[model samples]
Target chain A: MKDPLILVIEDEESIRGMLRMALEIAGFECIEADNIQSGHTMIANKRPDLVLLDWMLPGGNGIELLRRLKREDSTKELPVIMLTAKTTEDNMVQGLEVGADDYVTKPFAPRELIARIKALLRRSPGVLQDERMQVGKLILDGESKRIFLGQEILEMGPTEFNLLHFFISHPERAFTRGQLLDRVWGANVYVEERTVDVHIRRLRMALQSASLDYSSIIETVRGTGYRFSSRSVVPAAERFEASGMHSAHWQ
Target chain B: MKDPLILVIEDEESIRGMLRMALEIAGFECIEADNIQSGHTMIANKRPDLVLLDWMLPGGNGIELLRRLKREDSTKELPVIMLTAKTTEDNMVQGLEVGADDYVTKPFAPRELIARIKALLRRSPGVLQDERMQVGKLILDGESKRIFLGQEILEMGPTEFNLLHFFISHPERAFTRGQLLDRVWGANVYVEERTVDVHIRRLRMALQSASLDYSSIIETVRGTGYRFSSRSVVPAAERFEASGMHSAHWQ
Candidate 1:
């Protein structure tokens, strides 16, 4: 709810300046990136609360940059609004599929773009928590945006981090992939259920790399999807023993 | 930007009173319905900008009314936040699955509920444009929230109105079921893609009932889902001739 700083990733100097002027007039602090590479670097260096990415950068297009950001653990959760041209609506859809949070077509009213920026920022993933969370050996420092297993840091994609953060927050309960998609990814997205599987796998992998056998905390419920339990995480043989008489049953 | 009137459909009088006080304190006008039957009526008559529904009611639960509202094109777009008790989390999932926009666990802080209400209203479907739109004989009056074909009014569920509204606004372009779900239902909802097919069928049926052959504008684009073309209303055989070969291809 604080005054948000916005990063403008537009290749065109005129568009970037235009956006900065508009955003500043609306009382938002703004930064600029003229190409995809700089945009990505700026995102890492500046840590802007939200990003306004232009779809057609010279060295790499906006979709490429968007995909990279979404793929990375560090920047995946950043709210990104792509600036697109009216004729390139297909590219806009592609950008959305690759995880651009929202988009504004070029030749759009500046008012409309600012409105979208405000809306996207209002419920951005950043607003959810700023606390340290722990489940057994795993510790998620929401304030610093880092995860640790015992002593080692568990590095993962932004989505993976978010998935782990959610699991740590709500342990001992099964979440269907749909529910995970709704909660961890935020309800506004239209991501595929398969994406949840990919992120879960990456999260477990991150945990495993940090500490062997640590990944067993994340359990797969046959018909129900995934769940995280902080109890005895010994792989398969002790699984039945770990899940005592009060067992989870799926219909 | 106007002061939002929120309807709290909670059965417990104590909780209801608590909510009214909290909402009123937050500058929201409040109304209440103690059960599902009256809840539905209040929604129809009162037209609150947002709804806070408690999952359990005496005769029929809140899911029943949520389903009924989502099924009707008239109330489907209404923003509903289910007031779920923490113990009945599964019921909360069911409420969300049935199309309640968001949910808050009961014994929730008044501040959290007010925040959810504010966030939901910030991007409610009601905040979109209010202008009458025309596509062929079909006239979509965004101001009155009605659809008309020739002289007769075409009544639709709120979702259908939104779908038709979207289609009329973005005509001649095919949209996948996922895209339709995101655009029409609002990006925040996690509705199944199959729901799009059901709504499209209903919208077409409503158009057909008002007039004999007016349903042809809502055409299925084979593998691509659907599109609204105001050019030709003729079904099937004339379809090939009507699509005189700036043809669409699906991979």
Candidate 2:
């Protein structure tokens, strides 16, 4: 396969050089744009496989660029990661909410940045390998960002699909909202924790319409967190007579 | 260590005998209760490590038994798994919504039954060897069924406590509603999927009183499921500029 094309969008020459060098070393073909206009131009012309966007830029903001990318029919599905100097929680949330695929804070370890980049690329539908994930009757097609419950298609937003994809890939384990943001919303974002609840509500509502049995799939762990399990446990004493099973005795 | 005590509640003598024998082989001490009333009495007195409950009993239905157990302060913490012949999807939802820890269908293999029992026992707060699960400033005491946010005790219902406990124990993954019911609510229940949402709202409300950052801990994956994380990606992104650096590139 051809080397994955990576586009870097930033205003700092030094950082651009750094990213270009790192990405090239990591076996990706690198392209650089020094501002939003040039970035947009390059995106329109070059159509790189992935985009690395800096949150702050001259002429137009990084978020605006992201919105434009998402809004445009041609670029809506292109994966973009935000690079920002700000580490505040709200900014991270906003970036993710606006549809940035992932983000990285400034001064991050080169290895961590590379890993995030790779993960984002890997998660991009139909780009790399591992196209499908399943949990019980639920199936998520990463390539198409579609979900199937048995044979019927289940409709959901991008965020919900990503979240479900994450859960189906890893079952029987629980995750908190903060961790969810880190994994599903991406490592770099700033948003209110309550926002997770709103989205959860939305996701559930969508699933309910599909006639899929969503109850046994996502469990509330009470004051701790949430978990996914294939089967819920039966009370032991109740099990004996119902199943006509003999009880074990201990000395 | 002493063998874990398992209380078996069923009306059928032959089935009770089978469970007794099976549990003993699996290294558990068993106590038999032929009916719901007797089972409740034994639970109050014996405080067994786990309860194996039959859905249909002579005195009361298993659902009512679960409600009583969850309502009482002392027995509320006890983990209960339902045993039933019902294999329908609706039954599974109801069993979990009512607060059973897990469930096993009738005609289940002895090995499968034992495995489910062990998994539930391991997840029970006091029974398992792993006592505490910590993330950030939050601490979950599995033995006491308590949550401490930086030394302050956080009050929660049994369901919320279990949810939090599960999230802390298993981090960095997402869970769908169906999976949660199977793990947190147990199987063989017929409850509305909306019930999970109500419980989640209640759990969040309880956690809010403690000034704990519960919002960031549990995230909604929009169209898919819920997740728990230690960090809120959105909030963290706002602080990025403070790091004194920014990426420089365009696209």
Candidate 3:
């Protein structure tokens, strides 16, 4: 691929110079703007791969530019990494909530800035899109945050929904409680790994009440973890196919 | 270092016979429990290195037994593998989410069962433990999900927390986005590699807000990924001590 073009939007000439030097050395092509107005124009004209946006621009801030870019369909997916000195929880959360892919504090190391830019530019667009999945009679629409068994909708908590989504997406793989905690509970949540068991039970109970034998669907992998198996819940004939077994007879 | 003892808990006489024979042949000492109640007794009495539990038993299901074991501190860490006819998503998820170490479906190849058991037993206990680390003024306590610069706590999102944890644990090692996602995010997650950038920036922002200047702490390995450097974040006097670079000097 040609060198990824990075658009730097900062009012400080020195910071911009540092960024340009670091980016060039890191083999990235770059363009510059002193404020959002020029930044907007540069983006429209140049269509750079990513924007290294300053949190505080000359006129309006980077957040404003981020909002505008996200609002417009053509630029909605343009990746932006905010350069800011703000590191408060509220500020960082707000920046991310506004769809800044990432943010670097001012006085950032050249290598850190370049790494952030490379990472943002390398991201695929589908990462932001909600997906829909179907397995047998079950349907999960991630965008809608809804699940269906055939035509009937299943009521489940958001956490349960996420857990189910993960399991379905990664079928047949067994995961430990610790792994489940990291994956389903989010990596840094610090909840007891056993919490996974409670949620699993809740999910299973929900499925059970819906008249599905949940155990068959979520087979227990003794001593290891759990797996989403198509065969366990199906009739014996169907199970053979689900497990990739050609012969039905085990004896 | 005696051969690991494996407890086989299955109601089927033939299956139990097969497991005992297979386990013995695999050089494992075997114990048998025909139901959940008996399995509990055997575990309490024998303290087998691993349990091969069946999903269905004579009196109660294996999940109930699992819940009881995991609830108790002494037996909570005991590795368990579930043997079941159930292979559907719900069943597998329930079993896994409920804390079965791993599971194998009925008519499972003896080799497959042995392999799963071996894998589960091979997992180090450290994987399940919450560890704490100190890097200069930075204190990361995994159990509490807290990071501190001196006495002040730094607030960050779950992803950022995990990224920092991974970086600190394996300091100075450059990790590609793909590797970061695998080690920090669970292996099965299909997130965009660029998402690592978002988390890395978030971590840096958290560190920076606390006057940590983590750019030095989390170094960018250009054309690669990221690293945590003791020298960058610590004062010159402390850097020598932190990195063990006491004799080296830059001209």
Q: For each model, chain A TM-score?
A: 0.51, 0.52, 0.51
> Is model 3 an incorrect, acceptable, medium or high docking prediction?
incorrect
Cα lDDT listed for each candidate: 0.72, 0.70, 0.72
Q: Model 1 in CAPRI terms: which quality?
A: incorrect
Which tens-of-lDDT digit does each residue in B1-251 have in candidate 2?
35789999988899999999999998999999999888989998988999999989987798798878876777766778889988885665566555665677886787777766765454343223336655555667653345667646676787777777676555667888887777777665667777877877777666553445555667777766778765563245432431222211111
What's the residue-level lDDT of A246 in candidate 1? 31
The DockQ for candidate 1, computed on C-alphas, is 0.02
Q: Lowest-lDDT window of 10 residues in candidate 2 chain A?
A: A242-251
Q: Give the TM-score of candidate 3.
A: 0.31
Candidate 3 Cα deviation (angstroms), residue A17: 25
Off by over 4 Å in 1: A125-127, A130-251, B1-251
Model 3: residues with Cα > 4 Å off, grouped in runs:
A1-76, A86-129, A209-211, A234-251, B1-251
DockQ of each: 0.02, 0.03, 0.01
Q: Lowest-scoring 10 consecutive residues by lDDT in candidate 3 chain A?
A: A242-251
TM-scores computed on chain B for all candidates: 0.49, 0.51, 0.51
What interface RMSD do all candidates show, one decimal each? Answer: 19.8, 21.3, 21.7
